[model samples]
Target: MQDLVNLKVISLFHSENLVRIPELSSATKLELINLAYCRKLLELPSSLQHLEKLTHLNLRWCKNLRFLPSLYKATSLTTLILSDCSNLFSFPEVSPNVRELQLEGTAIEEIPSSVESLCQLISLSMEDCARLKNLPTSICNLRSLEVLSLNYSPNITTFPEMSRNITELNLQATAIEEVPSSIECLSNLCVLNLARCRRLKSVSTSIHKLKSLRGFYLRDCSRLEIFPEILDTLERLRNLDLSGTALKELPSSMENLIGLRQLRLENCESLVCLPESFHKLKSLWFLYVYGCKNLVIWPDNLFSAIGGASLTGRVEMQKDLHGLSSLKELDLSGTNLENLPTTIKQLTRLQKLILWKCERLKSLPELPPSLIHLDAHDCTSLAEVSSITKLFEQALLCKDKPYTPKTLACLFTNCFLLDQKVVASPGTPKLQMLFGHMFTILKDYHQASPQRNMFTTCFPGSEIPEWFDFKSSGSSINIQLPSEWYYNRHSMENFPGFVVSAVVSFQDYFDDAHFHIRCECHLKSCNGDCPNLSCSFTVWSRRGLHGSRLLGSDHLFLLYHNELVRRFVETQASNKCIYKEASFEFYPGVWERNWSQCISCEVKHCGVHLLSAATDDAEVQPPKRYKYVS
Candidate 1:
């Protein structure tokens, strides 16, 4: 090793009891040295300064290391890390060319004023420096310094003025009681994070002058009770977070942040009211207020201004909404809201509305037709579900522009009945309309694409619809296809146009469970031999808001496989005397493992629709062996 004077890189990490480094006095070309996690390493040889070309050094986690020697002459050094050296109390003068420096988790008491000599310093972090008292005022003179982080330095009472060139600052978990008015001096600062600064009682109103500020994070500042009143001048401000704070109310100035897009106030339990000026925020898109338990009243008169026809028949109606047309998402989960304003139905472009765990909410006004997702899970107090059905009707009937359609996804898990007083009266009518809309949707789709299978699901009742050609009490049913059935075609080409329907009741719910229902078309010869053709249809189940239910759906599948029809026809032409009837078998299954417990939801009804323009109502024919008991 003594003869290897041109060595450029050396790593000797995780070595135990390596108290003294071997002599390397002659290695002048050394540019990097790493001895990280050398737990027992006591010191670096002073001869390290002989490496005139050294540019990087890493001694991170060298627990027993006491101090570092000066590197004032190592002009090429650009990266230096002396982190987690608990026993080390001070860092020597770093080279001016160094661009990044980290001294986290150390006992360093103060940053030296000489740090200003590093004209090229771009970042300086003293995170978790428990003994740090203050930052040197001269640090503001480093024209090139762009980032300064003093997180977890609890003893730091006063944050000093920083360089105008600094674009971001982090003082999280510090003891600063107030941000001094000098904050205005940082004209170029774009990001400022004072999160968890419990001692920070107030912010200077002059901070609104930071024209370039685009992001501000004040999360979990427990003692912060108010915001500055000069938001009107923050034209460039786009994001602000006051989550987990102690704010009792939001200032009217907040509504003046026209360019702001997101505002977070989660866990601000003490907040009592929101100002009516919120309607003026035209560009505000996302508003999160999940845990504000005391916030009961939103801006009054929030309906007429947004053009939402508010008909608060029983509840007093006011009008505060002025220009909230651009607002897209709003969350009011875990609040004390009892009813939604009728104006909510006016947000034409809003896509998502979340009201999870709103225990006092009893009903909702008409929802905007543009809604795509509604998360109303655990809203047990929600009673009126008629509004939801009307919402669906409105969305489906985007009648003005018939060709353009909208899709909506909703979740109502563990929901309460819309009108629990009269189960049959309320449920029956709504269920009928829901099923009716579904049928229209399917019929319209069929008109659009005649050959594609039209499928739909509904939980209206256990009894199959009167339209099904066959209804059964058990799991299996057989349909006999008559030879003349094909000869009598609805088409000139002698092709039969038919669709299959089925009804099933779900016994249990599974997150990713599958149900397999297969149709087998088979013929048993006079010799006791059987030849059959089959096809299968699968149903994947997801967790439902309500418990398991029996479903009736229009199915297009397995029963109409061309192979079965062709084989039946071929067999028909060859031997018409063997048997006049072909056996059509329907079998329902859940993966064998879950089949035993899921036997209750059998295919209660099965049938086929033979189409004809003159046949306004396809007559349902009773099976030959089955008895039709009314």
Candidate 2:
């Protein structure tokens, strides 16, 4: 210990034990002490403060250390580290030179105002101190303090004069409701985070002029209504989010934000419409509108006006919408729409369609042949399966049952609709099966039998079918497509499901390659029937002449009779799936100018597990039948 003093080392902390400075006041040479991560040592000697040269001390991560010494006399100390000192509760007073201090994860609640005496301090990090509720007002005097991170400090609601020289600030998940307008005085400010400040309603109006700010966040302020006008002044802004706000419209001046490259409006449900001028965002590469349920329509010229830009990702719209022919992916299941527009055929790039719980839709229009995915679950009103069969080249059937007779018939007729198979797909085997199924449906099930009518006897509210006498207590109405059994050659569109209904049986010795059967049906009421009355029985037709090389059989079959098939195939193959992935990558940086846009963004993702394999094996002795190689 005598040798330690002669070396001019005032404080020597080796692990847990603090080697005492026996002649510390007399020597006057020792200036610092460090006993960081010392698990075995506990307390410091009270007499050590006499060594006036002692200026630096470190007792960080010492789990067992408890009490601190009185340092009112040692005025030269300049730095202290007590981070993760779990048992530490209080500390002694010292010189104002203590400019750098870290007490993170300690039991300290309120910092003494005397700390403000540290006039030369530059940085202070007190993160993760759950019991810490307030800061000393004296801290405002530290004019040199530039960095302060109170992230996850739920109890802090305000700061005093903290703007002058500080460049970075994070108050994520804090209780701050309003930022004082004086904040605009932060001339050098760059990054700010107020994510999940649920109670924050408005920002200081002068915030728009923070010319030095490059990044800003205001995500999930649920009740926030108006967007601050400060965005107009941020010429360098690159990203913005207003996902979960209550605000319904974007300011017309937003078009002037020329530097913005990413924008998010994920769940602003009150947003019923968008400004037509939004298409003028020439630099925008990504946009999101996933769950704005009340959003009824988009600008009619949305694509044409902005179509030249490289648009990518999920451009979400609410259900029941048939427009947006340029959108690559669509989700329309939760709404109350009965059908999609026939114009949907114009989208030649759609990849996925999700129609879940659309209970009112009884039939689907013909879909784009480009479709690779389709999900129609819980559509309880759907009785005939023919309408949805042509939509997907690959089907994900949720309800487990064999195809109904109607479905088989539609599949047989629409078999010719299959286009070129993807090169990566398995060869010939799937093609053969499709052709064989079509032949079986035409040869064996072509007989028009009313026995198939038993499936549709009861309607909603349990109304009996016409086949049964409703008055008889025991008579039950068989659910069937009510058959007129009597019709003239001219009018056939009067019945529901007429496009797929069995119109006529084969005449004996079928000679003419083409035959037409016209019918007129009469019913007391056309309930649960076609939405349009002028439907006609035009035979299915395909583009160009049907070549025998496309099929093994010499028979020629028409592809799709209704316009639905053409529309479905075109959109299903377009940009929908590809753009959804692009949107995910665009979200991180879009908070520069439009930080309020991502207030309500909630993404709906559907994942499908197409195949699962199970294997079982047992250990076995090798067979001796084969001769060993010599």
Residues 1-630, model 1: lDDT tens digits: 477588999888888767878677888889999888888998787777666899889888988989787777778888888888888888667678888887888789888888889999998888888998898889989999998888998998897788889999989999989988889889999999999999889999879888889899899999999988875567777889998899988888877687888888888988866777777777878888877777655676455321111134223334644456876787777765667767777787687787767766776778887775676655767766556656654544555443343444454434434323354555454334443344444334323322322122223244543334444554444544444433222232233333444555444533234455666655554445556756455443333322333333222211223223433445443343343334455676666555433453556655543332232232322223433322
lDDT of 2 at 412: 27
Clashes counted in candidate 2 amount to: 48
In terms of lDDT, which candidate is strongest? 1
State each model's CA lDDT, in order. Answer: 0.65, 0.46
* Residue 563, candidate 2: C-alpha displacement in angstroms: 44
Report the poorest 10 consecutive residues by lDDT, candidate 1. Answer: 305-314
Summarize candidate 2's per-residue lDDT along 509-584 as a digit string, tens digits. 1211222222222222233122111212222222222211121211111111222322222333232111111000
Q: RMSD, each candidate, Å?
A: 10.2, 23.8
Give the Å shift of residue 608 in candidate 2: 26
Q: Residue 274 CA error for candidate 1 (Å)?
A: 2.2
Error of 2 at 587 (Å): 32
* Candidate 1 wrongly placed segments (more than 4 Å): 2-6, 11-27, 34-42, 301-317, 387-408, 418-439, 442-630
What TM-score fits each model?
A: 0.68, 0.45
